[model samples]
Target: MTDRLKLMQGNEAVAEAALAAGARFFAGYPITPSTEIAEIMAARLPAAGGRFIQMEDEIAGISAVIGASLAGQKAFTATSGPGFSLMQENLGFAAMVEAPCVVVNVQRLGPGTGIPTAPGQGDVMQARWGTHGDHPAVAFCPGSVREAYDLTIQAFNAAERLRTPVILLLDEIVAHMREGVHLPPPDELVIIDRPRPAGPPGSIGAAPAYRPGKGEVPAIPDFGTGYRFHVTGLVHDETGLPVNDSRVADGLIRRLHRKIELARREITFTRACRLEDAQVAVIAYGSAARSARQAVREARERGVQAGFLQLQTIWPFPAEEVANLSRRVPQLIVAEMNLGQLEAEVRRAVSGKAEVIPLTSGGGRLFTPEEILGAICTAPGGRLKKVVHQ
Candidate 1:
């Protein structure tokens, strides 16, 4: 018999996943819809020989996690909309310094505490471009409670493997709702360790200890490993030293981008339901994916050829897969919590090959199955009619 399990809130699952992923340090401040993550982390991390600290604010929370990560411990932090916004500058710093860490944002209503307890997907675009500069970051979204566990592990692995900050984007509904989740055996899951320095301890010239080779992600040495290096936010060369030379700046920027971009194939993940013979496809991510799946199922029940493309990896935008599906489907509806954030990217990928419809909601509210069904039915040239839920 298959080993299947019981109910778990998304936040609790996140805590469990972090422990399983070897996260040794967590620092976060409590905020609605995301407080459970911090609470569970605080309670469970100690039992797993880990540490948890509740900082004064989100800024201090992220700063502490960065410090812990630099010390060679897997570190993480959790927050919601307003708190996530506070961590932006530090998140940018982590990206610039190529620190390995994870940040979980259980998205709530946005734009200055719009709704504390309600759910919202308004942070979709913020996850991508909230931080300043050209640094690369990866954000993953999980639709189910089980995925909350799986993807949290994936988020930490991606952070350590790529030597960058990874964001796990969860919505209020999924974060608060309880569902069955199977805890995978340790051996069954693949965990990624950060790249380590290959050269001798004292063999360093001018290059930084953490700087990697061309087209490669460098291993970051632990803080007290007798290897001395500098970490800075300014654009720097291999030595992590601020440089004014145009060629050095150019090389550093290109290499920073190339390392992550080249790893795109490893970073992208998606789920397709009933798309093999569908005339219409629905693209959704995060919590919205759950309702989209229901809408697709209902349409299919009525003999409509409808399917769903659920994104697990939101950043790096699975363009190829989406574009391919667009070619096969006549109509594509992009559903999100925001008013056309990922939808814009979907449009670009489809390139007018299919009719792209955007279904959005704000202020921490998620799209209902009825709303999604209506959007699908009213799509131009689609066979769907407005779905009325009583």
Candidate 2:
């Protein structure tokens, strides 16, 4: 049986879902829009037999979470744009070490803390290219509080399964919004744990800790569990020690990307609403999608055949599906809080298959449904569409 519907804020849902996903440690510094996650985690984690820590800064926060994950604990951290920027270097370090952990970025107006309490999705590109190298990036953006809860658990599972850091991107709109949701029973939820080396730490042959056992991801044993292995930021081999050879470096980097690229089908997720036999389609995500959905309904009311595409997975973007939509529709409208961040990706995916129209906002407010519906009606065939509507 499902639990009774309970009202919860988006950030609170993320914290609760993390707990349900077997997160035993949380390290974070409080920031606006995202502080509630840390606050709720602080109060709830200890009671749930978990640990919570408030680090001096965002860098230390992510570092601690990485360390905790290495020591055999499911760990995560939450922050906003400014804090997320501070964690980029260590985020790269986590990728290099192949540590499985989750990082939540509750986006706020940015570039340097533009607005602490306002919502903005300018981090869409940064979430994928924040770090300084060619490492794999996995990120998800939720459109509602319920999606916040579901995607948080999925983020943790993806981290463990992919052996990399997974980002859960939220905005001030959803982060603070309250919604009623019926949570699934704990036993019914699927929780994925990282693969651990067999035979405890030292019972069998002294194999390399990073050696791939079954799949591309290695089953590294927990630190201090009688396993002797090195972990470093430099390019390393299966033994986890630093390597200097070019071939070894190339191989390591390629494997890091290949593991994630090969699993694209499993990681990418999206929702197409009323796309069949539509004249126009709107691609939106996060809070912006809430408006796009209503716009679609309103457009239908006005005799405009409009569809909505909700992007749940932002990075490693659902390009193929977007291309498919472009083939079917004559025009595609992309609405987002940021100025054409993801719209650029959609254009690349469309590649002249259809007309690309962007309705973007750098301002810290959401676009209204009427605003989107206007774009849907006036996109490219404004005069002709009006005649058809009449």
Candidate 3:
């Protein structure tokens, strides 16, 4: 039920979606699988009255995004593994300063540039803990081309709404695959902009810069708008002044984490298929979920009670739902491109409630439905002993 339908690669969908979400500034370096996002933004941003800068490297790229966001522009950047690693310093800064920006990591097989063109979910844990300190984070994982577009927009929205850096974690397969998708009309889609400070820019506002009045998110005063504010990576007070007092630093950390904790219900995303009466469950995300979904179908055909859960939001781990699902089934099978990143988290959540099995690969290709189905069939006897231990 849409007028506009086009066959677009996942990167193309993400670029357009970011623009639609009002991303006016993009700073990124060229990296495989994610370079198309920068290319499209370079050509498209200017036409939409936005700015696009090709930074010297990944570190500079994310640094520019944080600078732009501080100046009151909705900004984003895209990069693959090695580049994503370089951005970790600024990523920590963006979180500390509460800069509302989006970072897209189209993951490739990597510790240090393992395979540029091949897909991998090895960045699952990195996206959550790559940065140095404890800070709030919201990361989205998409499974399909259309989902890439939707989740990209969600990344921007979450950044603005939460007043923190958000991540769109994609695999190379989703970034390169092309599919025709019918999108909803503009009016039907919901958009959220960054909150503006109620107090005058130059005046001593009643509330401090980082203090939230009603919602957990603080109102932002644009940099050029005469707002007297200080931004720093060090722990800061509500007034934006760096503090050495452990009490003040403790409060700031608590607030930073509490905001995300309170919003967990609004952030956790998962899709369950035929899990109502499943004897075994398949847990996966990104491209891995595609195979898991198909395996569920094939297993059902073979008279197996199997189901699949596609995780859309990777961080703030969907613990409650995962725990419930573990209680529902006798076993849970985790599938991913990496050896086992998400599997460890799921295993921790399940906590012996079910026999956890891992169907993983580090060879840059996606796991087959056959592999997932085999796990489901042999789940009872626990024949697959390759569980990822913490």
lDDT of 1 by residue, 115-204 (tens): 788888888788899998876769999998988999999999889988889999998898999987678888898898787676656774
Best by lDDT: 2
Please give the CA lDDT of all the candidate structures: 0.86, 0.90, 0.87
Tell me how far candidate 2 lies from the true structure as C-alpha RMSD in angstroms. Answer: 2.0
Ranking 2 against 3 by TM-score, winner? 2
Query: Per-prediction RMSD in angstroms?
Result: 3.6, 2.0, 4.7
Score candidate 1 by lDDT: 0.86
Count of clashing residue pairs in every prediction: 5, 0, 0
Candidate 2 displacement at residue 384 in angstroms: 6.9
Q: Candidate 2 has which clashing residue pairs, if any? A: none
The digit string of per-residue lDDT tens for model 2 on 167-258 reads 99999999999989877779989988888876765667546887765558888888888899999999888989998999998888888888
In terms of TM-score, which candidate is strongest?
Answer: 2
Task: Report the CA-based lDDT of candidate 2 relative to the real structure.
Answer: 0.90
Worst 10 residues of 3 by lDDT: 378-387
lDDT of 1 at 6: 75
Clashes of 1: 5
Model 2, position 94: C-alpha lDDT score: 91
Pairs that collide in candidate 1 are 119-364, 120-364, 195-219, 208-239, 377-384
* lDDT of each residue in 1-390, candidate 3, tens digit only: 646678899999999899889999999899998999999999999999999999899999999999999899999999999999999989989888889999999999888978899999999889999988887678999999889988888888888888889989999999999988987667777888888787686555535678865457788687777777788889888878898999988888888788778878888889999898888889999998898999899988876778889999988899888999988888888888888888889989999998888888985898888888788888873243355889
The reply for model 3, stretches above 4 Å from the true place, is 1-4, 202-206, 381-390
